[model samples]
Target: MRSSRRWRRLCGGRNSMDHTKQLLRISDIAAAAPDVLRYRFTAAEGELAPFLPGQYICLYYEIDGTTTGRPYSIASSPREAEEGGYYDLFIHVGGSFTSRWLGQHGTVGTTIRASHPLGEFCITPETPRKIVGISGGMSVTPLRSMVRSIVDSDTDREISLFCGWDDPAAMLFREEFTALARGCDRVRVRFALAQNPQPEDKHGYFTAEDILRETDAAEAAYYLCGPQAMYDTLHDGLTAGGVRPERYRREVPGELHCPPYPTAPGECYPLTIHTGSGTVTATAAAGESVLVALERAGVSPRAYCRSGSCGYCRSRLLSGEVWTDPDRAPATADGVFHPCCSFPRSALTVVLPE
Candidate 1:
C-alpha cells in the first residue's frame, strides 16, 4: 500500500511534470487544407511540455552536414499542456521546410525534438488598450493560441480579429475562429479573402479603408503578423487611411522575402569576408546571400532562425558593403549583419563576428 501510494504520488506530481517534458512524438498528422497539415505531437508517455500562449518551439532537422533549426509557433492553446498533455501545431508546407516536412509523415511513434516554449507574442495585463489583431495567411499560427487564451481566460475586454488570406481554401483554424466568435460576446472576427468573398465580405487585399470601415482605428492597439507583401500593403493603406505609426504593433516572420519599406540605394554586390582569427577571406558575389557564399566557400556560421528573427549568426562589419534584411537585431549604423540573410552590395571586407 505504501509503495502504491508513493508511486501514485510520484506519477501524479513531479514525475508527471518530468514526463511532461520529453521532446515529442508525432502522434497524428491531419490535413487541414490543400497545402496545410496539422502536425500533432504528444509527449512520449502521454505527457506534455508546459507552454504559454503565443510562445513558439524549435523544430530541429539535419538536412546535410549543416543542421537547420526552424522556430514554429504552437497553434495549440496553452491549456493543452497545463491542463492536458498533448501539443498540436498547424504547419503549412512551403519553401524552406516544404520538402522535408511534407516527405516526413507524422504518424504515431515518429520521434521529433522540440524546445520547451518560446516567444514574446502574448497578452499581458499591461496591454493597455483593448485587443486588435490583424494577420495574413499562415501568420494565423501565433494568434490562434492568443485568441483561444482570450476566450478561455474569460477576459471581458473587447477584441477584433481581422485576418486576410489568399482564398477560403487556404484559411487555417476556420472552425476554431468560428467557435471563438460564437462563444465570446466580446470577440468579433472579420475574415477577408482576396480570391473569394461572402456576401458581407471585405474583398482584395486588406486596405486601410477596411480598417476604418470595420472598427475604431486609433482607440485600439494593433498586432500584425503576415507575409511581406501583406505588410507592405497594410503599411501604405493604413497611413493613407490615417492610422498612425504608433498604433501599429508588428512581429515580423522569422524570415522575410521582401522589405516593407522602399529599397535602399544599393541592393547586392560582391565582397570578400575576412574571418576574425587568421584573416581568411572568402569570395562572395553581389545578389548572392552572405550565408550562401560562406557555405559555398566552406565556412560555417552558427545560425538557428536563418531568417533575421533569430540573431544567431549576427556579425559586425569592420568595414564593407552589405545589405541587411530589416527587423534584424539592433545593428549599428556602422553595419552589423545576420550573415544568414545578408547580401553583399559592394566588394568589401568584414570580420565574421560569429
Candidate 2:
C-alpha cells in the first residue's frame, strides 16, 4: 500500500482539470463489510461537480502503461457531495482493480482520475412519491445513496428498502441505516437473511408478495439491484403481479456472468486494426475479447458498460468472425460489432471510427 500521489502529481499539471474528468483524492477508506471497503473521495482542487444521488462515476487508471477504467456507484448523499464535494464508493476487495490497486497500493492521499457523474438511476421530479428498492450484496450502494439523499434533503418522498444478505456479518451500513430509519418516519428498512436469521429478520429472500404486503406497491416505483438470478426472480414476479415494466428499473452489476463461448486453446491469430491514423496489427487470442486485445496493444476505443449493454465501443467488422450472445447484441443492418463483448473466432480486420 503506497500512495498514488506521485502519479497524480505528474499528471495533475496537464489537462487533469478537464471539464469531463478530474482528479480525486482518497480522503478516507474504511471497511464497510468483511469483503467490501468504503472509499471516500474528494476533489483534488476546487469543488466536485454536482450529480444525482444514484448516479455513477467512472474511474480510470494507467496500469503498466495500459489504461483501464471501471464505473462505481456513489453511496454518499447528494447533500454530502454539496457540502464537502466528496462521495463514498463501496468496492468489493476481491475484484482485480481493487486487489491490485485500491487494496494494495491505495492510501488516504492517493489520487486518481474520475469521470463526471453519469447514469440514469436517479430519481426525478416526474418520479412517483414512493420508491421501493430491492437489493443484494454490493448492489445496495446506489440505493443507500437514495436513502441518504432523501433523509438529508428532508423531502416528503417515502422509501422502503428491502435488502438481502447471507447473514448479519455481510450486511453493509447496518448501523447507519438503522439510525436513519429510526430518525426519519419516511424511511422503512427490512432485512432478509438466507442463513442464521435473527429473531427480527426475515428467514429467507423477500418475494413480490413480501414487498407488496409492506408498501403501496401500485403507486411505488421499483428499483432493483443484485445478481442476475435475484433480478430475474423479482423482475418476473413483480411483472406477473401487475407491476408495469415502465414502473421499474434495474442497474447492471460490474461483473456479468455471460454464457461460456467457444474457446481455441493455445492459439493466437493476427488482428489487423484500421484507425484514423493508420492501420496496425496485434495478436488476438481466440477466447479473449477484441477490446482486450486492443487495450493490450495500447489502443483505446471509447467504452462504457463493457457488458455489451452500452454501444460506446461499437466498431466496424470489416472481415472476421466473432461470437457474442444474441440477446445482448444490438441489431444492425451493417457489420457493426461490440468489441467489448465479441470474441474473435477467426483472424479479424476491424475498423475503429475516430
Candidate 3:
C-alpha cells in the first residue's frame, strides 16, 4: 500500500506526471525471424497513452548499465492502444539491444522503458492518393499497421504494396498482407524478389523500369520503408524514374546515420550544461557528440538515439552556443535540443528542454 501510494503521488499533482512516463516492462517477446524478435510490452495498467494510427515510439533500453534508445514505428493500430491491449515492437535480435533481448533469458513481466509514441508517419482519414508501398525486408513493419487500420475502416482507395525480398524467408508479413489483399477489393499486391528463383518467379530489386511497368508514378503517393542503402538506391532510382519528390515518402532509420557525420579530429572544446534542477559542465572533445561527453562525465541526463533524431536527449542552449553538423537541430520553441550528436564549436551553455 505504501509503495502504491508513492507511485500514485509521484504521478499525481500540480505538474504531476504519470507512470506513463516510466520504464514499462516486457510482458512477452517472441521470435519472428532468425534474427528478429517481436516484443510485446505492457505499460502500467491504465497508463497507456493515446497514440495516432501512424506514429512511432522511442524505446529506452539499458544494457550492461549503459543507456541508449531507438525509435520504431508502432506495428499495431491506434485501436489497440486503448483497452489496455499490447503494442508491438520488432528488432533484429543482434547488436547491443538485440543481444540483450535475446540473452536476458527473460519472459513475462520483464521490464523495459517505452516513451510515449512520437513521429509524424500517418495516412489521412480522407486523402485518397493511389497508395503505393515500396517495402524491402522488414520495411513492412509500419505499413502492416497501416494496412490493418485502412482495411478495418473500409476506406475507398487503391493500396498497391510492392515488396522485395531475397526469398520467402526474408519476407516480413507474407501471410498477413496476403490475407488483407485477398479480402480487400481495392487493394492490389505485387511481389518482387532479388535472388534467382524458381522458373515461375517474381522480378528483382524494384528497379525504375519495373516500378514504371507496375504502376504509373504520375499521380501516385509512394511510401518507401527500408534500410539506408535500400532507401538511397530506390529513392534515387524513383526520382530519375519520374516519381515526383512530393509523392515519395520514406522512413528514415532515424537514429542510425550512415557514414557518421565527419567531425574533424583535434577540434575539441568546453561544454556547460545548466538545468532548472541543477547544472554540470565539462570539456567536450571534437569527433565526439555532446551526448557522449555528458554520458562519459557521469551526467545521466535522459537521452536516446545518438543521432539528432528522436529528440529525447533534448537540452537547451542557455548561454554559450554550439554547432550541429547539418544545423537541423530539433530545438522546439522552448529551446530544447538533441545533445546526442550536437558538438561544441566554442564554449557552450545548455539546459534540459523543459
Candidate 4:
C-alpha cells in the first residue's frame, strides 16, 4: 500500500500537494574517512530533484521518540544528481542523533525523509572570475559539490581549494580531489594537516596569509565553510588585509555556540511559546536562548542547524524584545527572529511554526 501510494503520487494519480516530504532509499554507503561515511540516496521513484551544487537537504530522523531534522550538504555535483538519479551526503560521526542513527541503522534498504535542496552557498554567474574555497575538516562536503560542479560543467572560472584535515588518515575525499586537480588545468588543490603532518601536506593551518599569497584578496571571491572560530579568524585577517566584506561568503557547520547575553541584575524573563497543541510558559534564563527555554518546557520545535544560517527555528516574536547573536542574526523586519540564537530581553510571546 505504501509503495502504491508513492507510485500514485509520482504518477499524478492523487493530489500533488499531499506529498510534501520526499522519501529516499539508501542505495549505497562507503567509508569516506575515519568515522566519516558517504551515503548515496535515490528517490523511491522518478528523477531526483535538481539542486545547486552547494545547497543542502534536511534529513528527518526520530530521536528519543521525537522527530527532528538535520541538514546535510549534497556532496555530489548537479550532473551526478541528474544523471545517476541520486544524491551523495558525507556525514562525520559527531555523536549527534543523525550520526548515531546512521552508525547503527544505515543500510542499503533503509528509507529516510528528506526536504528538497535549500541554501545559497553556491557559485553563480555573478561570482568573481577567480575563486578561492577554504574548507576545514568535514565541512568540505559542500565544497566538494562546488568543485565537482565546476569541473563537470567545464566552467571557465579559475578555482583554488585549500582544504584542511585533522590528520592524513582522516582526510575525506583526498584522492578524489587530487584526481580532480590532475584532470583539470583550471583547478588547484592544497591540503593541510593539523596533526602528524605528512610530507605532502602543509604543516600548519590554512591561514589568511596563505590566501593572500594565492590570489589578490581584493579581486577574488572567497567561499569559506567550517567551524566558527576558523571563520572568525579568517574573516578578521582578510578584512584587516583589505579584503572587502562583500567579497567572501561563509557557512558554519551545525549549531552555533553563542555566548550568554550579559543581563542586568534581576533581568530573567518568562517566555511564552504558542504552538498548535497549547501555550507553554517557561523561564528564560539570563543568558539562555528562547529555544532552550522551550526545550526546558519539553517542547521540541523542528530544528536542524542551530545556527541561524539554516533558519530552522525561526519564530514570530509576537511581543517583547529579544537579542540575537551579532554573527548569526538574520536581517529581518521587526516581529521575526530565529530562536536558536535569540535570547529574550523581556517577557516574550513567540508563535512557533507548525
TM-score (C-alpha, index-matched) for candidate 4: 0.80
**lDDT per residue as tens, model 1, 273-328:** 66755555666655456766666555545554557664556676766666776555
Every candidate's CA RMSD = 7.6, 7.0, 7.6, 7.0
- Cα displacement (angstroms), candidate 1, residue 190, comes to 1.3
Error of 4 at 336 (Å): 3.3
Residue pairs that clash (backbone atoms under 3 angstroms), model 3 = 25-111, 35-93, 268-286, 316-351
TM-score of each: 0.74, 0.89, 0.74, 0.80
Model 3 root-mean-square deviation: 7.6
What local lDDT does model 4 show for residue 166?
77
lDDT-superior candidate, 2 or 3: 2
Error of 3 at 260 (Å): 3.5
Each prediction's whole-model lDDT (CA): 0.65, 0.77, 0.64, 0.77
lDDT of 4 by residue, 1-354 (tens): 442332233233221222246889999999877788889999986667667667778787766665656688999987787777889998876557567787788899898888777676776555677788899888889988888877776447678999987777878888888999999987889999988876888888988988788877878888899887788778888888877878888875575333464566655787888999989887777666677676666675766566787665788998998778767875588688888888777898988888
Q: What digit string (tens of lDDT, one per residue) describes model 2 on residues 1-354?
A: 011232233234322333367789999999888767888999997787666667778787777887766778899976688776798998877776534476777789999988777666766555688999889877899999989877866457889999998777888977788899999999999989999888888998989889888877678889998887788778777887767777888886553323275465767788999988988999888766788788777775876566666566789989988876564566565789888777777899989978
Alpha-carbon lDDT of model 3:
0.64
Query: Who is ahead in lDDT, 1 or 4?
Result: 4
Candidate 1 residue-wise lDDT at 298 = 54
For residues 227-330, write the lDDT of model 3, one tens digit per residue. 76777677777888778877777775544332244666576677777766777777777665677676655564665435565455777766655556453354
The better-scoring model by TM-score among 3 and 4 is: 4
Tell me, by TM-score, which candidate is best.
Answer: 2
